[model samples]
Target: MGFADTIPARLGNLSFRISLDMSNNSFHGYLPKEMSHLRQLKLDLSRNLLIGQILSALSNCSRLESLDLSYNQFSGYIPKQGIGNLTMLKKLYHIYLTWNNFSGAILASISNCSKLAAISLGHNKFSGQIPNSIISLCHNKFSGQISNSIGNLRCLAVIDLSANNLTSEFSSSELGLFTSPNRLHIFKNCGLKGNIPDSIGNLSNLVILGLGDNSWTGSIPTTIAEINLSSSFLRGPLAPEMGELKDLESLDLSNNQFSGKILSSIWRLESLDHLSLANNSLQESISDNL
Candidate 1:
């Protein structure tokens, strides 16, 4: 398309650029090689039709701190050669490559960016186990267990491995070490199986936890509340310990094999807005103590 032929030549003439945001446009075709001309601190080209490989020429932007190419049609193995150069700058921190057509194993070269804090590659076609260096990963075709190596990311704060094909146990001891105050962990619609680890309670700062539509078999952890586990194959008595979440807002445990009396504790969540316990084998009886 003419887009591939014309835009870069025009963009190159602009000077003194600190950031460039050209997102949410219809700009299609390959990223122009002349993109390297602008030494922007950040570049956002998300939610567009940009396609083909990411240009290695972008590595020339030595001062670049963030590069977001999400929600696009960009495909092929992530331009590791291009990205490898960018990481060497030690300044790039956030790299968002979500909702693209990119595939293949995540490159180990990403680890070279030791200063990296957030790397969101969700909703891609990438296969294979997640790299140990990753702190934030999600929504790909990744299989196998959630690696215990993720515990190594001391600065880790968020993980959203939802809607993938992962099947295995979570590393309780490793995941328990996360101490971020605003942590959000989601692992819904995957093939994960095993007990909801007690160690999950350690994440006191958790605001959102999604574990729905999996094969997990266990009683809901009392330490967990305001969460979603609908359609997951969980079975066991719903623990009365759920009343501890005075701040609980939403709870969904429908379409499971849970067999027990609905605890009065659940009826007491003052912050509860949405509650679902449908399609379960629970005994129907209500405490009049409301």
Candidate 2:
């Protein structure tokens, strides 16, 4: 009786009215089947050692909203049908599954949770080009290209898909017979491969771009220097004229096949904090002023 093995019986009525905090306990084994009985529970069992499939019985808790089972050892695809039915909890918002082994394409069941302000599935094993609607976070293990439809995320601001296998197109051929302008759009650390798209310059309001760590071959977009296109697969020496973007922060064109002069344009990055032009073929008059 001294062990916290099950949901405390005295709190059943209040389960629907308050958030459950059973996190950071020694609880193990499959969640007891009776968890489905709490009709109003918004449970949080993160940071434990819970495992097994997210049970389908969760659908029975019709009045339930906001479930967090993150930071556990749970694996397998999120149950699709059961979670899709929780249509009434318009206030349900946060889902944090970081630091777990949960796998598969995200449950399209998430669309039912449309009011969700954030979904954190970082440090896990999700694959394929992420579906853009859900606004995924990729780092160090996933791969694939950022779908251009991602430009449609009008409210998106903070996307960190760094340190993985992300690749994308830079420029088609030249700026002459092209579609739009040359704006390099690279969401890194996914298996996205190929050259950078020249059309990216059309995204005139872009900030915090990352196209590093992939197989993209082309010249850096000149317009990109005027903007803030940093940490990407930029080839050739950075134009001496690049020190133009007044709002640049992190420029990491490292670990690729870029060659040419180390532009003092780097010094123009008045707001630059992290600059890594390492492991590229750069040769020119070095400026100590930068």
Candidate 3:
């Protein structure tokens, strides 16, 4: 039998992961609804001129784990059926739907993927408050404030939630995860204010803590013996207790109201790398046992 320009209907009989990839071949029209019968399958029809709404009938693949329908002239929202039978496939991970015109906030449906390690819904028109449960270390504004329970993810390594429309107070307690090896960067303009919490000292394993460009005021927490709090609007006198952080390599308290003599406790840091107390009104009198 010679190869024909059209997809052979007989190709469906493979009964196992049959990839009929004729995408972008100028194949105009609806996909054969019978294509859903393929068992143990992965379907890819992206980068095509295929036009029409995604079919909801493809939910028949009880064993289907992955699907790709990106980069096409397709219009309207994404098909939700491809995710209907995820109970059986324990190995399912990774789903990308980039360069499409999908819309709506699906906080309820995608939560079923409780075991997902990484998820991306970028380049689409998704909005509203991102669910607090589905996101532990990182999240964006689907709506609402940052979840108070976001501090539960103990295994999270890297977090990035810099750009969004959120409002709340970021406390040193939220940086509790720094006790582990993971680093954190929170550049929120979310009206965060008040004194620095002493809980940050618990992060013995933290490498970097980024809390710049916020409205935090008051005394620096003594627990944060090591960190850079420049341009954070951090005011008040430096507490002598902060020098207890022996692990601190650098301290940046420039442009703050830190006044009074330096605490005797600050001299305890054997691992201190740099200490910046510049541009502050302090009654500091440095002396040594000469």
How does candidate 3 score on lDDT?
A: 0.54
Expressed as tens digits, the lDDT of each residue in 1-290 for candidate 1 is 22322246567555467788888777777877777777656888888788898777777777678999999888888665577554655788888898898899888677667667778888788899877666445667888776675655656667787777787875566555455554666767578887877767777767777889888876665554469989888777887677677888888889998887887877878888888889999995664845
Pitting candidate 1 against candidate 3, the one with the higher TM-score is 1
Give the C-alpha miss distance for residue 130 in model 2, angstroms: 4.2
Report the poorest 10 consecutive residues by lDDT, candidate 3: 132-141
CA lDDT scores, all candidates in order: 0.75, 0.58, 0.54
What shift in Å separates residue 89 of candidate 1 from its native position after superposition?
Answer: 3.5
Error of 2 at 191 (Å): 3.0
Candidate 1 weakest lDDT stretch, 10 residues? 1-10
Candidate 3 lDDT, tens digit per residue, 86-192? 44333344344545555655444554454543334445555576543332222333445666544544444444444445556656766553454445433333444
Q: Any runs in candidate 2 off by more than 4 Å, and if so which?
A: 1-12, 37-42, 61-65, 84-91, 126-132, 137-186, 198-207, 218-233
Model 3: colliding residue pairs: 128-142, 128-143, 129-142, 129-143, 130-142, 179-203
Q: What TM-score fits each model? A: 0.88, 0.70, 0.53
Q: Give a tens-digit lDDT track for model 2, residues 1-290.
A: 12356444454445355568788886677776567667776788887777787777767676666678878887877676455344544455666677778777765445455455455677778766565444446543555555554444444444556555655543444322223222333355534456655554445555545655555555444344323234445566565535765666666666665676666667666777777766777776665755
